[model samples]
Target: MKAIVLGTLMAAVAATGATFSKSAEANELALSLCTYVQGDDTMRMRKKLRDSRVRVRDIYSGIQCNGQSLLQFAMSNGSQDIGEFIVGRLSVDELKSSGDYEWAQSNGHAGSPIAAAIKERAGL
Candidate 1:
């Protein structure tokens, strides 16, 4: 029984990974850039995202490249951790004034996983 349970858990994890793999490509790229920002490449990522051609907002609206952006990748994957790092480093105003906040409060995504993370770090 224990072996069966472990196998089932592993299978579930694998399936979840597969599902996340199918997520929007732009969102995924944005998340990757977020990770890079959270890592040591904040400057490079910021510059890249700032380019007019980079429109992560289309994938998940309410994302603007101002220093105020609270954009994040999918929480179930590695994006959440990177997001947390970026949130910790960003200023309070940036966190509070992010488009994610408006979208979360106005839309039904109030407790959205990513928004929740931003709020938690931003102290909003």
Candidate 2:
């Protein structure tokens, strides 16, 4: 009985460790994605997402780069390619609900190409 209990505890600990490891990896990926956006490295960003087998649409809402959403961060950093890429990847409903267009207009990015992309994607 004691041996069985020990095995169970070990299994639980291993599972918990694996969960934390996955969470850490996710955080690292998020950081890398944000850095790529800030640097306007669309190719690397695409590669990272593809290699990780994660879609932008899946992770976009969960990622906040310096208190801004990925789209907002891209626009603020003048990352037009990445901004458009992200827009293309997201669904129309996601685009509309993201409020990115309004954020752009309010943040003085109304004239930016990214703002235009947001407007088009969001159908505003």
Best by TM-score: 2
lDDT string, candidate 2, 1-124, tens digits: 9999999999999999999999999999999999999999999998999899999999989999999999999988988999999999999999999888889889999998888887877778
Model 2, residue pairs in steric clash: none
Against the true structure, candidate 1 reaches a TM-score of 0.36
Per residue, candidate 1 scores C-alpha lDDT tens digits across 80-119 of 5445555655567666755556665665556656667777
**Cα-based TM-score, every candidate:** 0.36, 0.96
- What is the alpha-carbon lDDT for the whole of candidate 1? 0.56
For each predicted model, how many residue pairs clash, with residues at least 3 apart or on different chains?
A: 0, 0
